[model samples]
Target chain A: MPLLKDNDFIDDTWQRLDDGAAIPATGDILVSLARLLADFGKLSNRDGRLGVEFPNEERPGVLESFLPDLSLIALTFPKFADGRAYSQARQLRQLGYDGELRAIGDVLPDQLSFMLETGFDAFEVTERFPEEAWEQAASSISLTYQSAAYQPRRLHVWRLRWARDEGV
Target chain B: MYRYDEFDHRFVSERVAQFRDQAARRLSGELTEDEFKPLRLMNGLYLQLHAYMLRVAIPYGTLSGKQMRKLADVADKYDRGYGHFTTRQNIQYNWIKLEETADLLQELSEVEMHAIQTSGNCIRNVTTDHWAGAAADELADPRPVAELLRQWSTLHPEFSFLPRKFKIAVTGAPNDRAAVKVHDIGLRMHQNDAGERGWEVIVGGGLGRTPLIGYTVREFLPETQLLSYLEAIMRVYNLHGRRDNKYKARIKILVHELGEENFRAEVEAEFARQKELDVEVESRELERISNYFAEPAFETLPRLSTGYEAARAGDPAFAQWVRSNIAAHRKDGYAIVNISLKPEGGIPGDATSEQMRTVADLAERFSVEEIRVSHHQNLVLPHVKLDDLHEVWKVLAANGLASANIGKAGDIIACPGLDYCTLATARSIPIAQTISRRFADLNRQHEIGPLRINISGCINACGHHHVAHIGILGLEKKGVEYYQITLGGSSATDASIGTILGPGFSGDKVPDAIETIVNTYLNLRQGGDDSFLDVVRRLGHQPFKEALYAPA
Candidate 1:
C-alpha cells in the first residue's frame, strides 16, 4: 500500500465498506464505533482512514494523542437520538487533524450541511441507497455556520456582529 | 421587514431551485442519506425524537400581517396547527415529515420567507432588538445594518464550512435586549464624540456545555468598516480555531486558548491582508438599505393622551397590562406593546393557528400592519397610537394573547424540551407550566417584581437558562428526570452566568425549589425597586444557595 495522492485507483491495506454496510475488521483497516468499538491509540497503523462513532454519554473524551497519524476519520449517527457525533465531529476539527473526515451510518439527508460544518468531507454512499442522493444532500444548503475545512473566508461574520459575546 | 431586492430575490429563487433539484435527485435515489444529511440541516430540517422539525427564520423578528397569516396557514395545512418560536427569533414546526419539507419551504417562499441557514453550521438568521427602529433609546435604527449583514452573509462562498454553528446578535440600544453577549459575534451600535455611529465589537460568547460571556475585541469600529472588520475576525477564527475536538470548536474556545491579545493581533493581520478587497459599504447601497427603514409616517398627535389616561384609570386590568407590556416609542402618541406569548399555563412561545390569525388581524387593524417577535418570546406591536391602545387591548383581550405578564416572573422563557425536541434531555415547557400555575396569582407575581425564570432541556441552553435570573436546566440521570437550579444569571446590560446550587431535584420537587428561591429573594431584598437580578448581584449567591439547600 502507498499514499494514493495521485487520484489514481490504488488499493490501501484497509477494506472499504459501502454506505450502511456493517463494519469489517482486519488487523490493518481502521474502523469506527458505527459498527464496532476500536481504540484509537491502540491501532497498529495510520495508513487507513479510521471511522469514529459516538455512543450516548454525559461527556465524551478528548482527542489529544490521536491527531498525529490520523488519515481519515468518519463520524457516525447510530440514530438521530444520538447527537454525540455532532460534538465529536467538531472536536476532531478543533484538534487540527487535517484529514478527510467523513460521516457514515444512519446519516440522513437533512444533516449533511451540519455534518460538513463540524468538518466532514467524504460521505460513505451505501449500496442500499441510490448515489444521486449524495449530490442532492451536499448541495441542499448554500450557507454555513462558520468558515471550516472547505470555506476559509466568510463575510457574514462581519455584518451580523451586533453585541454578541462569544466565549473566550 | 426586508423585502428582497433584485439580488436577494434572485439568490433565494436560485437557491430554491437548487434545493428542488436536490430533492429530485434524492427522490431518484442519487443522493444517499450519508451524502444529504448536511444539506437538509443547512435548510433547518432536523430529524427529531418523533419526526422532522423545521425551523424557519423570522428575520430580525419582523414580519407583515400577511406573512403572519401565511405562517398560520402553513401551520394548519402542514404542521399540527401550532408553531413554537425559539430563543433566536425563529419558529419550529415539530411534526414536519422529511418528504414534505421542500413543499413546505416552497410555501414559506410564497410568503416571502424561507428556512435558509436556519440550522446548518452556517451564518444563521441575523437577530436584533425586537423593538429595533421604534425603541425610544436607540442611537440609530440597527435594522438596516442587520439587513445588510443578512444579505452579505447569505450563501457567502468562503464561510460555508465553519468548525461549528455560529450565531450573531446586534443591538442599537445600550439596554442590550438582544442578549448579544451570548452570541458568536456581538455588535453594539455606538457613537463617538464626533457623533459618528460605529460599533463596539465582541466575540466568542456562546452557551452550550461551555457557557461564556463575550468580551470586547474592538473598543470602537467605524460604521464604514464594520463589515471588513468582521471579516477579519471571522477569518482569524476560521484559520486558527480548533478542528479536532467538537467541544473546543466554538470560536469562544479558540479566543480563550489564544488569549484576547493574540486573537486580536491575528485578526488585525488577516484584516490587513484583505484590505484590498474593498468590502466596505458602498455609499449608494448603504443609502438604499437605510431608505427602506425610514420612519413610518407620523401624525402630529398629542404626546400624552388624556383619553388613554382616563381609560387606564377606569380599567384596572388594562392599567396592569399597560404597565407591564407597554414601552416608550421614538415617536409621540405612539407606543410599543409587548403581547405575552406565555399565556397563563400554556406553552411559553407556542401560538395556535387561530391565535396567530387573530394576532395578525389585530396588527393590521391597530399597528402599521407589522409585528415583531422579541427574543424574549413575545410579540411587539411597535407603532400603536396611545389613544388606540385601549381598543387594541380589547382586541387582544378578546384573543388569548392578553396576558399582563410581560416582564414578570410568570413570563417564563422556555424551550420545547423532551416533549418536542430530540436534543432535549427533559421536558422544559411542562415545568414552566407548573411554575406558572403555582404562581398563578397576578398580585403575587407583581409583588415578586421583575424576575426571569428560564428553562432548558439540556446544557445547550436554548432557553437561555444560564443567563436567567432564576435558571432551571433539565438533565436525565438514569431513567428519571433531574432538575439543576442556578441563580443570579441576567442577560441585560449587566449580564452574568448563573451559579448552580447543590444537587439536581426530581421533576415535581423542582417547582417547590423555585418557590423557595423566589421567597428567599423577596425576604432579602431591600425594597420593591430592586429587581431579582439586582438583589442577586448586590448580595452574592450565598443567600440563594442557603435557601435552596436548607437542610431537609
Candidate 2:
C-alpha cells in the first residue's frame, strides 16, 4: 500500500470510489472505466477531478473523447505475468495524453524499471521497498535500446557518448 | 562470433547483478514463486522435472574455440559434466541448482554468452543457418543482420510482454537450412531481378498443433528497412494478437485468424506509420557488426588433396564418414564438417564435457577456431581444410563423435521427454535410442538415404516432429504411452506439415512400426538415390499406413 511516483513515495490524494457510494464534493477520485462509462453524465457534474482505472480488457480507444477531462489513468495488472497492461499503457501515452500515468496492482520491484521506461510515471505498489531499491532498479543499466515514451527521454546512454541517433 | 563490446558487456553484467538480487529476494521470501517464475524464465532458468535447467544462448549458433571451451568448463563445473543442445541452437544444462543460477550466468557472461530471452513469453534467441557465412550458395552472410536484430530486440522496451513466445529465423541461402518457413517470422535474403538485395519477409509459420507455413508479407524489404519492417510486424502482433487463450496467443494464430491479406494490410499500415522513427541500423554500425564475421584466412591449396583422398581410400570407415558428414564449402580445398551428436544408441544432441573440449581443441588446431551449432542439434566446423580432415576425423573418432549419420535415419532429433521435462507425457529419448540401436549399421543408414526421424513426447513440437520425414508424437492413453506416426513432412524450401497415420502404437511397437514403414519404402523404391521423403511424396502415407497395420 505505497504510491511511488518518480522514485519517491508521495501522498495519494485520490480515493477509490466503490459502487453505491456518495460522490465526494471536491477531491480527486479514481473509478473503473465501466463505472465512468455507465454514469459519465452524473459523474462529470461532480466538483472533484476524475481518474479512470482500466481493467486489463478495457480498450483505451473507448476513452478517446474522455482524455481531455482526465487527470490520472491507472493501468491495472491483476497479476505480475499478465502484461496486457504494459501495452495498454504505451497506447494511452502514444495518444499525447500528458497526464500522470500510474501502474496499479501486482507491482514488483524487478519490473519497476521496465514499467518506468514504458512511460509509467507512477506505481501503486503492494509491498513497500526501500528508496535505494527503487533507485537501483530504475537506473541499474544506463543504456536502453529503444527510445522511451516519456518526454526528455532518459533511456539512451549512447546518446551521452555520441551524437543523437548516430552510429558508433 | 560477435565479440561483446563495452556496451554489451555492461548490459550483461548489470543484468546478472539484477538477477542476483531477484534470486536473493526469492530465497528471503520477499517474492513469492508466482512473482519469481517469470523473472527466472526470462533469465533462461526453468524448474523442470528434477532440477533447474539452464538454457544458454549461442547467438546464431556461432561460437569461438574459446567460448566453446568456457561452455565445456561450465558444464564440468556447474551442473553435470555434459549439456544438451536444443533445436533452437542453444545448450541446456539439466541439473542446475537454484542458488547458483546467477553465478553460472556470470560465468557464461565472461565468455560473451548469456541465457537472456532463452525462454519466457518473449522473443527467444534469433537463429540462422548454421552454415551462415561459409556456404557457397548464400547471397550474403546472415549473421551480421542477425546480430543487429539480436541487439535491437534485446530488452526492447515495448514488445517484451508479447502474448506468447515469439521466434524469428533468418537465412541467406535459398536452401533454408534454418527451417525459416516454420518460424513465426522468417527473413530470407534475396536479390531482385534488378540486382537490388533485400529480404523476403514471411509471417505466421509454426509447428504446434496447428502447423502452418509462413506467408510472405513483403516480396522485397530493402536491406536498410529491415528493422523498421520488423518493428511493424511486432507492433501489429502486440496490439492485435489474441490474449484470451494461451494456445491462440501466438502471432501465427492471429495471422491465421486475420487471413494473409488482412494481416499484410495491417502490417503494411504499421510499417508506413513508423517510417519516420529513424530506427534503422546505421551503415557504420552494420559495418562494425559485419567486421566480426569477416572470412578467416583460409590456405590456398590444390582443389584435390592427395593426402585426404589416400586416407579416405585406405580407411573404409573414414570414407563412409566423409560420404555422410562432409559438405562442400565455397572455398577450394575446404570442407564443412558436421560433427554428429547422434552416435549409435546414444541420446541425441547430448554431449559430454570431454567431447566439448575435444571439439574445442580440434577447432583450434584444424578448423580456424570457429564452431557452429546446427538446429538439427549437430555441430559444424564451418571451414576445415581438406588435408587436415583426416586429422580432425581421427580426433572425433577417438572421442566417439564420428557417427557419420548426418541427415540419415539414425540421425534422430528428439526432445528430453518424461525423463527431464515436466511437460512431457511419454519418454521420447528411450524411443529414439531404441530406433537408433535398431538402425545402428552405417551401411544400412546410408542405404536408407537422407531420412529424418523426429520424436517429441508431447504435441508442443519441441522436437519438431511435425516437420520431419517420419514424425512421431507420444501421448498417454489410459495410463499407457502411445505413439502416433506421421509422414511426408518437410521443413525446407518446400515446407509442409506431416499427416497423422491412423491408430497409435504402444512404446514397444513404435520402433517396429517405423522399420516397417522404411522397409515398405525400400521395397517400393524406383531408384537407388531416391530419398525416403521423395518416395513418401510420390506414394502417399497410405502405403506406409497399410504396411504399419498389416497382420503380423
Candidate 3:
C-alpha cells in the first residue's frame, strides 16, 4: 500500500494495528477503535503520532470529547457504494478536528477529488496505481459547483464568476 | 427560460469530457460493468429491457425553442424518430447505445442541458409547476428556485452516493399543479402574516411500492435559507438513512421510522448548525437567476380577443382544443396552451422529431420562444396570444400535435413498462394506448368529464399510479400480464393515495374494466360539476369495484 498526501506519494511511517494485535512499543501506530479503547493507557503514553481508526458507522461526535490530543484519524471506505465514510469525513472536519484525516480501504482514484473536498488530507492507496494517476484524479475537475466542508479555498462557479469579472 | 451562464456551460462541458473519459475506460475494460453501471446511471443512462435508455433533464421543465429543436435533432440523428417525455418533466430516448451516450451528452450540453443527476441515488431534477410563470393563479415563478437547486445538487459531493435516489418538487401556486405532496421534498411557496412569501417545505412523501403523503417539516422557510435547509435534510439522510435494506433506504423510510416529529427535530438541529456554514449560494446569486425567469415582453391587448372568439365559433375542432388545452394566463390576451403528446391511442408522451420541430417553430412564433414539459407528459406553450391561437392550432393540427385531451381520460400517464424498462414486470404503454382508443370519442370524453387513468408496469410507480383517479398497476402472473385497479387518488391540492379496487385483470380486460368504472361514475354523478375524482370521493370504491368485477 502507498500513502498519498497533498497529491504526492510519501513514505508511510504509520503502522496499522488490527484488533487483538499488540501495538509495537516504539514508532507511530494506528489502531482500530476497539484496540484503542482496550489499550488506551499504554498507547497514549508511548508519544508517537496518536492515530485512531474509525469505522464509517461511528459518528465523528464521539471524538469531540476524547480526540483533542489525537494527531490523525483514518476512516474506512469499505466499499465503493458505501459512502458513509465520506459523510463521516465531512462531519469530522465540522467537529474542528485539525488533525490529519486519512481515507483507507477501497478508496479509488475516481473518488480522490470528492475525498479531497470532504477533508481527507491523506489516503492509503493500492501501490498498483502511480502517483500521477492520483494527481490527475485530484485535478480532474478544475472547478466544482458546491462548496465543500473542508476545502478552504472554494472554487465554486459562483465565486469563479466574480473572480473572472474582477480580473477583467 | 433560464439560460446557462458561462460558468454553467463550462461546468457541463467539463463534466462531459470526464464522462467521455469514463466511457473510454469502460470500452478498454479498465472499468467493469458493475463499476461502470453507477457512473453511467449518475449521467442518466439506464440499461433497460431492450437497449440503453438515456434520460435528459429539462431543468424545472423549462426549455427554449432552440433547445427543443436540439432535442428533436438528437431524436432524429441518434435515436429512433420519437422521444418519450417523462412524468418528471424530463425526456427519455428509449433506444440509445451505450457507446454513443457521451457524445449525445455533449450535444445536449450545447443546448444548456445535461443528464446530470436525472438518475442515481442523488437529488434528482427539481421539478416545478409546468405553468410556472404564466399561470394566472401563481404568486411567483418556481423555476428560478428550481434552477438554483439544480446547480447546488449537481454532482453534490456528500449526497451523490445516497442510500436511494431523492426527488424534490416545487409548486409556486396554491393549486399544487406540480404534485408537490408526492415528492421526497415538496416545496410550496406561500405568503406569511407579514405578506412576505416563503416556502412551506414538505418532507418524506413518495409513491413506489409504499405510498406516503409528505408531512410539513417547516411552515414557512425563508426564501434565502432554502439551500441551508435542504442541505440539513440531505446531510441528515446521508448520515443516518438505512443502508442495510435497499428497499427501506429512501429518506421517506427514515422519516417514517423516526416519526415525523423526531425527524423534524433532527432536521431542525442540523439546519441550525448548517445555517452558520457559508455553503449556500448567495442571495445575489439567486436574484441573478431570478432575473432570467422574470416576465417576458407581452403585446398590449384586451383580456378577451374578438379574433379568438370568432375562431372558436367558426371551427368546432379548434373550439374543442381551445376549450380544453388553453388555460387562463396571467398576462392579458395570452393563454397557456398545453400541447398534448397523448394523441388518441398513441404512446402517452412519445413525440416524433417532426412534431417536436413543429412545436419549437410554433413556440418561436407565438409563445415568447419558450416551452415547458409537464409532469402530465405534455408540452406547454406558456405565452401564446389569444389572437395567434388559431394560427398556432393550425400548425399543431397539421403536425399531429393538437390533442384536446389535456385533462381527459385519453390523456393517460403511462411509464415505459416491459416495452423498455427492465424493472417493469408487465407493459403499461399498450394498456394506455388501448384505454385511450376506447374513449377516443371527443363528445364521450367530455361527457365523462375530467378523469385521470394512470398505469404503471410495476410497483415503482413511474406512471404515478398511486396518485391517479383511476390507478392501474400491472403485475406478471404465470407469464401473463395482470392489472390491479386503484380508485380515488389525487395529486392535486388534496393529495391522497388511491385504494385498491379488487382482483387483477388480464391486459386485454383492463381497458373494459376502466370503461366500466367510468360508466359507473357517470351513472352515479350528482351534477355536471362533479369530476370523476369528486364522484369517486363521494361514492367510495364499492360501486366501481363491483362494476369492474360484475358479470360481463
Which candidate number maximizes TM-score?
3
lDDT of 2 by residue, B1-552 (tens): 688777778889998988999899999997789878988998999999899999999989999999889989999899789999999999999999989989999988998899989998888899999998888898898999889778777877667778889999999998999998899999999998999989999999999877889999998998887877887798778768888898888999999899999999988876775543444334445677888888888788889999999999999999999999999898999999999999998999999999999999988998889999999999999999999999999999999999999999989999999899998999999999999999998999998899999999998889999999999999998889999999999998999899898898999998898999999999999888888889989989888878888786
TM-scores (chain A) of the candidates? 0.57, 0.89, 0.88
Best by lDDT: 3
Tell me how much of the true interface, by contacts, candidate 3 captures. 0.48
Superpose all Cα atoms of candidate 2 onto the true structure and report the RMSD in Å to 1 decimal.
Answer: 2.5
- State what share of the real interface contacts each candidate retains: 0.03, 0.42, 0.48
Candidate 3 residue runs with Cα over 4 Å from true position: A21-23, A38-41, A152-154, A164-168, B279-281
- In terms of lDDT, model 2 sits at 0.87
- Model 3 chain A lowest lDDT segment of ten: A145-154
Pick by DockQ: 1 or 2, better one: 2
Considering the true interface contacts (CA pairs under 8 Å between chains A and B), give the fraction that model 2 also has.
0.42
lDDT of 3 by residue, B408-445 (tens): 99999999999888899999999999999999998788
- Rank by lDDT, descending? 3, 2, 1
In model 1, the Cα lDDT at residue B51 comes to 89
lDDT of 3 at B292: 86
Worst 10 residues of 2 chain A by lDDT: A152-161
What's the residue-level lDDT of A117 in candidate 1?
54
TM-score of 1: 0.79
DockQ of predictions, in order shown: 0.05, 0.43, 0.62
Give Cα-based local distance difference scores for all models: 0.75, 0.87, 0.88
